[model samples]
Target: MTTPENSTAPRPIKATGRFMLAHPAHIIAQGFGSGLSPVMPGTFGTLFAWLSYVVMTTRWPEIFTPLNWLVITAAGFVVGVWTCQVTGRHLRAPDHGSMVWDEIIAFWLVLVLVTPATLSSQFAAFLVFRFFDMVKPPPISYFDRHLKGGFGVMWDDIVAAFYTLLALALWRAI
Candidate 1:
């Protein structure tokens, strides 16, 4: 597809470490380079989110409380909207697969809500979140198709996170 004459989107370019480092938005929206993975960039972004969550909470328990995590995730989501928008414009692909900040931030939301659990449970959460994200069931698919801009890019994953949490909650209740 060709960008319109009046489009603000830039000419599409390959996502590279050089390009990622060229702008703060690129760095953030690319999941700090995890999005550069040649294979399953979204999965890699989620992995980065899980590992970072573990490291931060474990290494700085005093500062990385659940309350703190709520704040961080909220801030991440807001920042992700802008970063993803800017990066999308630069890439000229509004929802380029390489832009995995949506995955990273969304999985961070999952981790925050399902924490204080065993590694096995966290892995289960990861699997479920990935399933919902990739399958894009119903409204998730709807938003992914109809929403535009950075918010559109990020919203579907938030829905996926909700699905994941709902599944986990049901599992726990059973």
Candidate 2:
């Protein structure tokens, strides 16, 4: 999944200080260290988001409503902008692969959009989101290139999520 947009050249991350238990920003920004994977960290982070979303919705039940998910996603997206900004600055990359708060939260937005989704549909959403995120078509590419800092780091994935939602709606129509 290493595209020019998501270059995989290993950047030397300051592991100890940023990843320490005291660093809440680091923890949230890195998707709890899923981004540290040597391979496909974004994929891992998206999977982590999926599993966490499924678990929370399944276990809590009360907070699984559509309204709640939307509110929660909006809040998380706000936090994610800050997380990506801090981590991107720390890593010195506008959209670093290891700063996977983008992927994790973006996929969560997809999950919320496709709620009550079957396993197949959820899997489809995953593939589509990852594809848009990786390929970054049109405006996605524009945002990725033109935008900077945390919001820029996070915007393309939000665009990808929108694309995924559109795809899902089209799929349902067919």
Candidate 3:
């Protein structure tokens, strides 16, 4: 059956590059096309977060102070809420794997806490964060299953970031 033109029902979307560019929300929610990767789009989005965070902080060190990063990351989360919601509606999936803004913003938060370290340390953070995110142990898995809509899509990754931070803290203490 054909859906009504004005119906609020979400329609399945083919997440192509064309679709990614079709709307501003799509661009942001899709991690500027990094989410188009057929394999491990979330990892790609997190990589984009790492590279972009490094570039921005290195290129504009004065502006990307820890405080500024807090602000920027907070703003990104707020924006991701809206963009993910809108994009999710368009994609007909509350948390489409291709919508990686959650990963991007969440990883940005993770990196914000782990900077001023060696490249190896940063890579470790990447690996740990990816593991927590992919495995979704305990509370992360609980929230991921129960939470709904844009907030749900974005929040699980935040828990993964927390787990990453906790793991990093424990490693540092050891």
lDDT per residue, candidate 3, 4-120, as tens digits? 887776568878999888889999999999999999999999999989988998999999987899899899999999999999898888889999999988888888788456688
Candidate number with the higher TM-score (2 or 3) = 3
Q: Which pairs of residues collide in model 3?
A: none
Our model 2 lands, by Cα RMSD against the true structure, at: 5.4
By summed lDDT, the worst window of 10 consecutive residues in model 3 runs over: 1-10
lDDT of 1: 0.91
| Overall lDDT per candidate, in order of appearance | 0.91, 0.82, 0.90
**Best-first order by TM-score:** 1, 3, 2
Query: Candidate 1's residue-wise lDDT over 1-174, tens digit each?
Result: 555887675668888999999999999999999999999999999999999989998999999988898888889888989999999998888898889989988888888789456798889999999999999999999999999999999999999999999999999889
Instruction: Name every residue pair that clashes in candidate 2.
Output: none
| TM-score for candidate 1 | 0.92
